[model samples]
Target: MSLLQDLFTRPRRNEQMGSSNENRSVLVVGLGRFGTAAARTLGELGEDVLAVDKDPMIIARWAGKVPVMEADLSDPLAVEQINASNFDAALVAIGDSVEASILTTGNLLDAGIPDVWAKSISHQHTRILQRIGASHVFRPETDGGKRVGHLLASRYLDYIEIEGPYSVVKVLTPPAVCGQTIAEADVHGRYGVSVIGVKNPGEEFQYGSNDIVMRHNGEIIILGSQKQIDKFIES
Candidate 1:
């Protein structure tokens, strides 16, 4: 879509989640892929997403999707303007430029925006963000690893652990009784699971080693929740 269309069409992140009982603004520092996606999610969810970036191109890309501006993200002064007590929640999704990202996060915290989520490029980056009072930190690439680990160890990448081992996950094929069709991996009967999708190598990506293209480094995405995933990982 055109830049104009991108601006008007892309929704921001979830504002409802960002605010308390009272409405509040959400600050999204950085307009990269993650920031853009988050901004869209919040905006579409009826939240106010105020995003910032140094590049006008980046700002223009998200023109109307969310309230965006072109400014040096690390500048505390610029951030102070957007991050008054008015911002209930905030996030930093800057990638590659570690120094600028950390500085921006520090500025956000100093501005007293209560809830903050910061993306990290490395453990050190996380440390600094933490020092600056980032409430939540995530390493997207590292998180993708946990997913890959679950998929590689089992035949499913379905559920996340809410509490403990008692997980809720879905399946595509059940566990094999005796190597039946791709659909025959009846994980349900064999392990009391649920099937969601099924695919073959040349067919489609339902959720199976046969269909999943393992990376050269031997990573795969399967289909199962944390409980069933344990079984896959053990083997």
Candidate 2:
């Protein structure tokens, strides 16, 4: 039997392979930087991952971290070798070539992979992947754009998009705002945002206390709309 067939048909003892372990299988097609990160993260999270790449060199880099395979992902026959349905999700992370990305995405969807996520370079590419039944199309550059925005703004130390139009951001308390308690800061009242947590230098995050004074010595994590965050930063 082929490697793919062996992967699927091989029997496992239920007691030896707990139900949680059985449920965490994922297939990641393409081993570019984005793909490699996804595969490694999933493996770290205790998932059984089959990470594929067309380039042997890329596959070699992550061999021990995740189960790596070299395959021509654009070919439908090659895709069919795997029992695609066995995976809880599949990620098509081929970023460079639009054609290769689309073809691999189509093959995975056609082979009945339930959840297929494709990386897209543009809106048009996203639409094509979506039309081919990709469950999700992620623009990796969106985060890069957010990071750039933060860098330009200068007030924020870091920011992450949480959902539509909202983010979790970190910033230092300005000298103007130091010595006041969180309640006095009235972050939500004054800025239309909420302070979620605070972290001092070399310390873990803790829930913001109304009584704890801001010393301008640590970072504050806030959750709010981007507009609200910008307003807070400007103020």
Candidate 3:
């Protein structure tokens, strides 16, 4: 049998479910790159996922892996048919067709799905999705570019942007702070950055403590605004 045919004959995850009302169940619409990635990660995280798409080939590929359904999510009736409201959250990952993306998002909202997250390709798309009641809108390409830009411009071993202007960064202990305890160096008072965690050369990460000494080659995780973090790193 062909791969698609073989997948079609296999038992689907949805069919094996004891109950669909389990906590953390998610409804994922659209089986594009973003959608598939989200579904797979959610599955690995132990969330029950029902992934829906209109393309039979996409459905075939995902069958028995996670819950897969073939349906036109742009159509409100189709969304209702699958009982999209049964899940705790829904993700609209349609990237190519703006019209379909908007329609699917609207359909989910109309179904009373409280948390509807959508992926937007442009500013206009984001605004429309928000106006139409999408709970959250993300631009993966734009966000990924900004994240990569931060990594490339600094000595940061890792960088993660938090809410507003704040960020969490991992970097080698600065020369100025080396060989001093957090309290002795007055890291917070002098640099305006909070050392939240630290990892020695061969040890696991540990919570930052005032008494913990900072070593020259050790790594520390700092939390502060971008400017403060940059200033601390430059010191």
Using lDDT as the measure, the top candidate is 3
**Hey, what RMSD does candidate 3 come out at?**
5.8
TM-score of each: 0.61, 0.75, 0.83
Cand. 1 Cα-lDDT:
0.63
Between 1 and 2, whose lDDT is larger? 2
- Candidate 2 CA-lDDT value: 0.79
User: Candidate 3: where is the Cα deviation over 4 Å?
Assistant: 1-23
Off by over 4 Å in 2: 1-23, 55-65, 112-114, 131-135, 175-184, 201-203, 208-214
Worst 10 residues of 1 by lDDT: 210-219
Question: Model 1, 1-235: lDDT tens per residue?
Answer: 7432343333333333443454346778788898899988888887656787888888887786677878775887876554344567788899969998888888878876789899999999989888878999988888778667755765554544334445544433323332453234444445543433344344554544323322221223333455555564343
- lDDT for every model? 0.63, 0.79, 0.86
lDDT of 3: 0.86
